[model samples]
Target: MWLFVVLGAVLVLVGAVWALQGFGMLGGSAMTGSTLWAVIGPIVALVGLALIVIGIARRSRSS
Candidate 1:
């Protein structure tokens, strides 16, 4: 449960960075200004959010 939360948080941060880079908000990377990253980033973030929700739900249920 805790593992899920930790992993999810990391993924969320990574996804945010990817999205920013994709949108040209962040630079100096190969992914900057790439449309593919722009699309993939949000998807990854959503997945992370789902994992976080699952972790929280499971933790609450166990408690």
Candidate 2:
């Protein structure tokens, strides 16, 4: 449960960074302004959010 939360948080942060870079909002690499990253970043972030929600819900139910 805690592990999932931490993992999810990390994923979310990473996804956000990717998205920023993809959109050219945070330039400084080959991935910056890349269309592929722009598309994939949001999807990854959503998955992370889902994991966080699921982990928290499961933890609460078990408690």
- State each model's CA lDDT, in order: 0.92, 0.89
TM-scores across all candidates?
0.97, 0.95
Expressed as tens digits, the lDDT of each residue in 1-63 for candidate 1 is: 998999899889889999999999999999999999998898888889989999999999999
List runs of model 1 lying over 4 Å from the truth.
none
lDDT of 2: 0.89
Alpha carbon lDDT of residue 41, candidate 1? 90
Quote the positional error of residue 20 for candidate 1 in Å.
Answer: 0.5
